[model samples]
Target chain A: MAEAEGEMSSLLEEAAARRAAPGRALVRDAGLIVGAALDMAARFRRDGRLLAFGAGASAADAGHLAVEFTHPVIVGKRALPAISLANDASAVSGIAVSRGYGAVFSTQLRMLGRPEDIAVGFAVEDRCGDVLGAFAAARQLGMLTIALVDGALMDRTLVDGTLVDHVLDARSGDPRIAGEAHMTTYHLLWELVHVFLDDPAPLDGPGTAASGCAADATCVTCADTAVPVHVTELRPGGLALVDTGGGTEEVSVALIEARVGDTVLVHAGEAIAVLGGDAP
Target chain B: MTGALYPFAAAGGDTTREELVMSTAAKAAESVELRLRVLERLGPSLAACARAMATAFRAGGTLLAFGNGGSSTDAQSVAQLFLTPGRGGRRLPAISLTGDSALLTALANDVHFDVVFARQLTALGRRGDIALALSTSGGSANVLRGLEAARRAGLVTVGFAGSGGGRMAAERLADHLFVVPSSSVHRIQEAQATLCHVLWELVHQALAGAEAGGVQAGGEEASDGGLGAGGVGADGVGAGGA
Candidate 1:
């Protein structure tokens, strides 16, 4: 009895340690997930849906992630279309038993995915054969491939273009930690994608160069109605007084060194970047 | 170069690569430390949960588990663990209310989602049955409703929730509540899994007689020794998977 008690304590601590190990992995690798989310959001704008797949315990993640996107438990958030390839366990097993386990998810993707859709697959072991098949199938369909993997093949993912474009690796040997890391990665993707959707013409807009600060945000030409501006006064730090076709306004000049009478690009009371010379 | 929330190197072009490497290393060390602390704190409560669950199971009660989202998976896992009991333990009768897609969809579509689990419990639950629910937030309306239904039906209600126990604690819904006092959802889920394993083992120990004997139930795919691995689990969509 005493021995059982001691072992239980030890087991709890061990499980906690295993579970806790993913936070570091999330912090280090979550940026790559964010970058992928940005791309996926662009795909979303094109009316693309998300298709997710995984095997074993990870199968549950596929369902959880799908419901999160489709139903959106949070109030006021719009639902995004998502489907879990593993939702129908009968079909999955039927395929596995009849055709092969590898064909289960791939067959689903071939039937459901489109060229503009996004395919996200996850795995816990060094390789989830079914997930690998799904990614390959999705890539062939011209879908964007995102993999949340924490297995031994993680190092090879960066080198393998055919396997995945955006790979967020938990870098853990434990499945529990990998599962936790995958959740964090997907949550970050959901959040960062929302950040992109919150804008009509975000950083990728025509007039915006995606400069470091908002002071350098170029909405002048992008906004479609800003008038041409001529620099009337030039101060240090790229600050400029410009005369819009309408009136004089002050704008920041971080992108360009504006001189008096120089044609400066200004947007909503800010100078985006300076034109090389005065407007014709 | 220092960081605000984390100890990170100053962002610079030349040192960025080296700094990122250092930052990951430092962050890993810190995370392991925090995980260990969280684990240490959960030991006692996990023990309590095991003792309680063992008593309930030994008394011939069934475990009816439920949850939402990722937590629903946890509830299913809990049921699977009890139903199989792996190697050393006698298989106990447990059902995950979330496992039935037909029932889940019907309840969700026909009436309302809040009553999905509660309605099922009303029909299926009996006195001396055990109800186990998993919710990271502890505030999931459905889980709360299910727990209330389980308790009213004479079932012993237990909950696995994240830090602060959310509304589960606020309303005292669970008879034996296991709270993973972590704000991070990942950590909380992981801790919850660990707690379940501990509690499951204890329940088995309580039930495993000399005739039952010890069986290896570690990591290896230890299928049935004498019981046979028939219908290993309810794989959500159907009866079993290949």
Candidate 2:
């Protein structure tokens, strides 16, 4: 087992070494293209919508990227223009069966994608009919295109004259790490796109992060959210109360407390908790 | 030993309480492991399929789910999860192919069990609709038939199956086949419940633009509580606390 572990470590080192190469050349090139993508995203903010597509690992990446744009973590941030192509199963299957799997995303791009919209194509393997067709259709529609291709399969011609404005070969490491790396690449890109949207001063400041809301947490009742009521009657599950907000509207069987004038979050049909108290 | 152990006696030895408990635990762990591995490996594909379902519903398309036995129950549970609101937002248009006894019995007895799901798909499915089928073995004839019919009807097919994906994994009928590897029915069913719950939650997460699916406002969002007069009567399809 020790010998096996030693051999595995050596192989990982070699793969890592290969990735960190290009003598600053590739870094400069990637920076330029990433800059271009940021600009295109700014253009999308103006008049275009960005549509992302992929299958398998690619699909997850597309969804993750779309979520970042659609659901910005920043509290007051408005959503940017974006949609994930992989999210529509009907379109994919319809195109796959009728026109072939290759035309699945391509058909949708042709129909719904406007000239101002951008198409971001992610391909895990070299020969993907769906990816190719989507790229072609997006180009024909005169929309900006970006290809996040994996490893050494970087055939520059795939993007040549077509509307593919940027190609970032994320030269991701070995088979196991490749998919995850692609995900990380896009996650980073999603954040960078946000940088293009917000002002520069806030960019220097710490970026906003997601709140850690668990699956089981209920909405905590506080004075700000719930309307106060006076307990008029008590029922089996909880309480009945008269609304303090206005004319004698009655609320029945909510929360554990039936004490008159006590506020509670009316959860479900029944009130489940007391205001400013730990949720039951 | 229980009566169920008699079948196993023919191939091996008598079943013991210790063995049954240990095996059940092992099977549960194995099933959970396999499910996590598949999700980790096929994250993008599954996420993509889920996203498509979300988009289809958002664009006025409906989601339909089906299966046999335990899978049938799972289908109903998932449909109910979506059709009802737990915390946030209103109910989306989702239907379980197994919910209506009249339709199921009619399709099962008149045509054949194999055509039960297929015929339903034929009648209801349209372009941009999503058809989700669940089977632990992934080899249910009725499920496969339904998948074929869904494909013919231009609906996206997603299958959740187990044990090396069986026929559904190989037939290419499922655009996405999430295979839970363990063979134990109990473990697979438990994990299937978890998987569907996650998908249902994701649908809500995507819809509400919330990070997690939390309990929000319940019924009384509107006069009819988001359900139309004739559509989805006051069983309060979208009413549930947490």
Candidate 3:
């Protein structure tokens, strides 16, 4: 009896100790997390939908986050638009079967993502190819990309500013601990986003970039207008340089097949469709 | 276009950026503190439950998990953790009852939403198997029905609930019930996830000890010997009709 009691205490102590570091780390990164929440609120104000995806256990996190946003539990909390790419098993499986597993999330993002949308990807480890692919597709769509990843990803540069705009690290070697920390971080995100949204003060006051809108003209991204532009050069990572009549600008051509000299409809810094005729 | 359209400057407000950051930090700290307290309070019961689960697993029993909303996703995660533990942890047989949307919707549409999990448990549960239910509110109709079904089917019923275990505890539906003493749904869920993780680890520990001790078969005997004689008897572990 004594031995069993000792074993239970030891197990409990170990479990408690394992989770401490990750929780402390989350508290330490509160500033960054709040900043990300502010940005998310800005996107939401622009009527941007949140698209979240992940693989394995992280898939559950994606669904959990989506449901929280789309169906607010607390009374008086407004429901923000959100969807989990991992929720539809048929779509995920079909995409995997036709284009391979790595293309599942990217394909969905290409079809569903908009310029003002927010993309949040979760991964217990940094090595999930599907998550990285989805981030690439999100960036190409001019969506604000956020990554919730394990501590090992903190040292990696693969998900740098080029792909993910905000990276929240769980900072735990153990997957279970990291997963718990991620839940806390995202819960904080959901709460803070509401806080910012409910606050009367404008998120982007006088000096800041105009609501952090990627487009330069009329905020057409939120306006749901697509303008025709001529592609001048194709850049790496699915980016294309386009001539918008006023000046040259860079846009994402990931959704459609676009080549240099091709006229494409650019909306929210992304080429939505390729026009067959000459640039207007 | 104009500054009027894009008003997101750091202007004067009752709540500044620093205050928001501080609020977030405080929430995180509160979550951490709640988790620690819950673990400290429920550690013994969790350990006992893990031993029971290990025994069931050794006897070729499968784990069936169910819940609602956020708890539903958490149930799926718990199943995934056991089915594909990774990191050299042994794979276990498990299924999330919430995985099949079609069946769930059908059951809810045809009969009622409250019986979604209950109907699945009635069909799948067997003697000595494990039924793990999660509910942040502790009063989810579907979760309560699922536990009742598991108990009827002679399965080892375990529940993770918040706000004092509600109907599950009141009715004594679960042989083992771990409740997070929090009113906030988010904090309850975050702590529940940690609870599941700790339970998973403890089960693995018990299984490893069993393997090392060379007690392969006879699940009840192995559990009794491994846990120490009379330490956690059949009644204490609720060995499902033993």
Expressed as tens digits, the lDDT of each residue in B11-101 for candidate 2 is 3443332333343334324433544554445554555566667666766677789987546645765665566533333576778897577
Question: Which segments of candidate 3 are over 4 A away from where they belong?
Answer: A1-5, A200-202, A205-280, B1-13, B217-242
* lDDT (tens digit, per residue) of candidate 3 on B1-242: 11121123234445666666776788899899989988999898898999999999999899999998888899999998888766566778899999898999899999999999999999999998999999987899999999999999999999999997899888888999998998889999999999999999888878877776786833222222111111212221112221
Q: Write the per-residue lDDT of candidate 3 for residues A1-280, one digit (tens) a residue.
A: 4665577689899889887878888999998787678778867866788999988788899999998998888766788999999979899899777876767787788888887789998866543547776776777666788888887664354344445778888888677888888898888888778877877353432212222343244443223357888988986546677787767776667678998889998754557798875454
1 against 2, candidate with superior lDDT: 1
Q: What is the interface RMSD of each candidate, in Å?
A: 9.5, 25.2, 15.6
Lowest summed lDDT across 10 adjacent residues in model 3 chain B is found at B223-232
lDDT (tens digit, per residue) of candidate 2 on A20-47? 3321223334343444445454445436
Instruction: Give the Cα error of residue A141 in candidate 3, in Å.
Output: 0.8
Measured by TM-score, the strongest candidate is 3
CAPRI verdict on model 2?
Answer: incorrect
Predicted structure with the largest lDDT when compared to the true one: 3
On TM-score, who's better, 2 or 3?
Answer: 3
- In Å, residue B118's CA in model 2 sits off its true spot by 1.0
Writing each residue's lDDT as its tens digit, candidate 1 over A172-215 gives: 76655666567656655664565556542333433221111222
Give the Å shift of residue B59 in candidate 2: 1.1
